[model samples]
Target: MALEGLRQRLTDLPQGRFGVAVSGGSDSMALLHVAAETLAPARLCAVTVDHRLRPEAADEAQMVARFAEGLGVSHDVLSWADGPFARETSGNLSERAREARYRLMADWARERGVVGVLLGHTADDVAETFVMRLGRRAGLKGLAAMAPVTHFHGVPFHRPALDERRAALRGHLSGAGLHWIEDPSNRDPRYDRTRARDALRHLSAAGLDPDDIAAAATHLRAAEIGLQHLLSDWATRHARTHRGANLIDAPALFDLPSDPALRVLGGALRHVTGVAHPPRAADLSRLLAALRSGDTRATLHGCLVTRDRTGIAVLREPAMAEASVPVPLGATWDDRWIVIGPGESGMSVKAVGAAGLSQLGNWREAGLPRAQAMSGPGVWRGETLIAAPELLPDGPFASKFARDDFPAWLASH
Candidate 1:
C-alpha cells in the first residue's frame, strides 16, 4: 500500500490538534505534508528547531515554516539562544541534537496544548534500529526498537509511519506532487549510523526485506512481553516497595527464570527510582551481591541503596558537613574568606590553579573537582564546586563564586 496507508492511521487518531516536527528533510517533510492534509491542520502547528549547526539550518527552518504556511498550518521556528554549544564537536553530537530537538518539541506542545507530536521514523529506520541493537549485544527488549506511540515528558510521540515503508513514502510524496530536501550527512563516514545504514542496505540487497525484519522484531517483542508478565507476578509475590526502600528477595530473583529475572527486576528498579538504563552486567551482579553481603551500602545513580534486615533502603548521600568544617588555607566557604586574599566586607574570594587542588577522596567520579582546604568553613553543593571556606578558597572557576550574608543556603533549591 502507499503512504496511502497513512490515511487510515490519520483517520483513527483523535480529532484534537497535533504538532509535527518538520526539519525540511524528505522523511519529516513528507510526514508534515501528509499529516497536515489528513488532519486538516489549519489548527495544527509545525515546530522547526534550528540547531544552527549547519550554515543552512536557519534557512531550512524558514523553508519548513513556508511549507506549513502554504498548507495553512500554524508554524514556529525555535532557535537556541544559548546552549551546550552552538557547534559541539563532542563524541555524540547527533544523539545530543536528537535529545534537544525532542525536548524543544515537547515544550512547544505543552505550551500550545497540542495533543500529540508527529515524528517521521519510517519502517526502514525501525529495521535498521533492530539490527543496530542486535550488534550492541541487546536483548529482545532493545531489539524491539522504537514504539509506534510513546508518551514522554507529557506529550505523546506518534510515529504514524512505523508501519509504512520508506520507498512507499517517497512514492506517496511523488503521487502527492511534493518533493523534499535530502541531507548529505546521511552518507558521511564520520557518523556510525551511516555505516550501519550501508550495512543494512547490503543485507537487504542479499534477499532480506522490511517485512521479514519487522516480523522478527514483532516476535521478539511478544516474547519479551510474555516474559515481563511472568516476572511481574514473581515480583508481586516476593518484592515489596516502601516509602524510601524496595525489598526484592534476592534469592527469589535468582530462582526466577533468568531472562525474566534480569529484565523484570531491572525495569522495576528503573521505574521505582529515577534511573537511566540498567547497569552493566558486572555492576548489576556486584550490586546484587552487595545487597546479600555484609557491605554497608552501594551507590547507584547518585543515591545509596542498602540492604537491611527486612528490606532495602535507598537514600540520598548525606552531606559531608563535618569534613573540614573549619576554614583551611586555600579552600572556599560559601564565597566568604575562602583563600589568602584581602577580605572584602561582603565576602571576598580568590583563585588557584590545578596545582592548588588535590584529591580529597575517591570521589572524582562524583563530577565535582576535588580540592584541599588550606585556609574557613569549606562549603560545596552536593560535591559540586560551590564555595570553599572563607579561610581557604582555591580551585578553577573559583573566582566566580559570590558570597552574600543573605545565606547561600537560602538561595539553594
Candidate 2:
C-alpha cells in the first residue's frame, strides 16, 4: 500500500517525457527508477547538477550519472564553476542548493525538448518545509510547502512524488536494488532544514502522522492558488502598464479585500520586476509599508515603484554607460543613452550600444562633455559625463541627466 500509492498516482497522470533530478540520494533514485519503469526509457532523463561547492561534489554527481546509466536512462552531470555564493536566504544552504539544482535541471530538460522536470520531494519533506516556514512567520503562501506543478523560468516543474511517504520511496529504492550517495551536508546542523527535519522526525514519533501535516499543506495551497487566481484577474482589470512601468490606482486597490489586495499588488510587482522578496514576515511588512505610504516613488530590488497623485508606476532603474565596452552585447551589458543640452529646451536623448570612440564623434560635435568611463557602475551628468553617478535620482528626467548625458541630436531625429 505504501510505494504502490505513488506508482498508482503517477500512472494516473498524463504520460510525457519525464525526468528525475537524481541527487545521488534515496528519494531521487527511487523517483528515477519509478519514472524509468513507468515511462519509456527513451523518454526519461536523469540530470545531476554538480554545484562544485563541496570538494566531493563532482564525484557525487558522477555517482548519480552512473546510477542513471545503469538504469538504462539518459544521464547528465552539469557543473557550476561560480564558487559558493555567500548567501543567506530565508532558507539555508541546502534549500538554496535545491533551488539552484531544480532550476538547472529544468533548463536542461527544456533545452532537450522535454515537457516536464521532476523532483523527489516526499511527504515528510513537505511537512518539514511547512513547519519551518510556519515558524519563520510565513503567511498562507509560504505555509503551502510546494506546488505539484509550476513553471520555473519557462520550464514546467513537477513534484508528483511529494505526496508519497519517504519510507515508500526508500522501500522502492530498496526493492529496485538501487543505491545512492549520502550528502554529508544533510547532517550538518549549520542548516535550518536539518534542524527542522529532525524536529519533524521527533514529532512523527510523538503521534504526528505525516498525512495530517500534508493535508494541512494541501488546504493551504488551495487557498493560495485561489488567491493567486483572483489576484491575477484583479491586476488585469485595474492595473495599467505604460512605458515599461506599471500603474494601479490607490483608490481602486483599496476597494479589494486586504489579503487579496496585497496578493494582487505583490503579484503585479513580481510580474514587472522578475526578482521578488522571499516570503518572510519582515519582507511582508516592508512591502505593506510601501503600499500604504504617500511616497510617490520607492525602489525595491532595483525596480522603482512610485505612488503619485495618479497611481503607482514601477520602472526599472536606468543605467548610464559604464566603461567603454563593445556595444550591443545583450547578455554582456546593456547599452546606454544620453541627453546633452539645456534642460529648459526640453532635450531628451536615446541611443543604442556603446560603440567605439568614433561613434561618439557626433555627440562630441554636439558639444557635450563625456565622462571618463569605468565598467560596472558609471554615469553622466548633464552635458558633461559626471565623474560621479547618482546612486538614486530624484526624478526620471534628472536621472537621465545623471546618466551618460549625450547630445539629444540622435533623440531629436
Candidate 1 runs further than 4 Å off: 79-91, 238-250, 272-282, 292-296, 314-413
List the lowest-lDDT window of 10 residues for candidate 1.
Answer: 404-413
Candidate 1 positional error at 176, Å: 3.3
Candidate 1: tens digits of C-alpha lDDT, residues 1-413: 45667767877887788888888877888888888777777647888888767778888788888888998998998775534473555545675576567656776887788899888888788788787777788877788757677654336888888777878778777887887777778789776667777878788799987668877886776776665566656656776543223456666655666566555445544433323346566666666667656534666533455665545544322232132233333443222233443333333232222322342333233333222122213333333333442223344322322222111111110
Alpha carbon lDDT of each predicted model? 0.59, 0.59
Compared with the true structure, what per-residue lDDT tens digits does model 2 show for residues 216-301? Answer: 99898887777666665566567765423456778777787776666655654444433323334456457656767776455554
> Candidate 2: which stretches are off by over 4 Å?
12-15, 85-99, 240-244, 276-284, 319-413
